[model samples]
Target: MRKNIQILQDIVSRKGSSKVLTFSIPHVFKALQLLDKEGFVSRATFAKEIHLGEGAVKTLILHLKKAGIAESTKSGTFLTEKGKKLTNQIKNTITKECKVKKSSIIQGKYNHAILLKKYSKMIKTGIEQRDYAILYGSSGCTTMIYKNEKLVFPGNERECFPRDAKTKKYIIENLCPHEEDVIIISSSDDPFVAEISAKNAALWTIAIG
Candidate 1:
């Protein structure tokens, strides 16, 4: 889960080396596209929303130009019809790796204990600001869905662990999170990477919010 700036930089440098761009480029446009759902957002406003400095933000705009997906103007940068169409394609294709759901703004605080020190920086900054954030971390490829207090995942018992179940239960029970709060979950066969994805998801949640 690299930040928008890093991702944008990668997109620019990685050009000609790879036919495909990093998912972050589309992810950024997706955020802008969502922000623009109602209309265009000022450069300053968009920068704040995406958590990037002015220079870094401008760099992103430039990358979008190269892709021919975004258009910039005095009013601000916006997704062209081309940008919007590409965003949808990316969401259905590239972004399928993780799913995010946002509920109406609700009450309660995040459980800091679940956060690991190495990965705590972004979440810490988010919570400190009292911004909405949900940290979802899990090991294994099993997907956990909570509906009506039931936890469901794909796999045989051996494929999933009781600890994983416990972790999910603890998150749901302790957080008492509202549907409005952003819930970000990421899974990988590697627990460490999954943790990274979850943190990235947390950042992504804030970006979209």
Candidate 2:
């Protein structure tokens, strides 16, 4: 079967909590951000965390309240009982997906993991030009394999993989790549594809950064 077609199908068919995890909410990020900051943060801070306008933040908070996941008061916005449980559930799922198996680490010159953002499409083209790429991942993961080549990504479920220049630098330093190495970037939100692709490798070192 064609590897690309199969991978596309798998991405479309992923279901249940996996789907929930795939289509993350903008407001959820804000709520989680507040949760991370001891369960309360000012509106301006919330807006800054999610990179949204002040009016947009207010609207999102209202949405969160309607969804029974958050509330707002003089103290600040906070998660409700349901919200905490949901957040925990999401966290647990991501943790399970991202768990790196020791067996997947391959020994070679070097294997690079990149958080593909500006260069994702370019890398995909490079792999295709080189010929034959086997692919994997659920809705949130993207894994491609070719002769002596492998790529693990956070799929295309989101509009774009979250990133910045600082994040990119961090990836390079951590992955410790060499010249001509294949840099595969994955989202922390969905690492299942990358993890599975690495573990399933027959050759080549697949490193996740």
Clashing pairs in 1: 103-179, 103-180, 104-180
TM-score of 1: 0.43
- The per-candidate count of clashes, in order, stands at 3, 3
- Across 68-161, the per-residue lDDT of candidate 2 in tens digits comes to 7677889888888866766664333222122321112222122223222222333433333112112433112223321122223323322121
Q: Cα deviation of 169 in candidate 2 (Å)? A: 16
Model 1 alpha-carbon drift over 4 Å, by segment: 1-30, 91-142, 145-150, 157-209
Report the C-alpha lDDT of model 1 over 90-149, residue by residue, as the tens digit: 333123222222111111122221221122222322332222212323331222333334
**TM-scores, each model vs. reference:** 0.43, 0.39
**lDDT of the candidates, in the order given:** 0.42, 0.39
Q: Total clashes, candidate 2?
A: 3
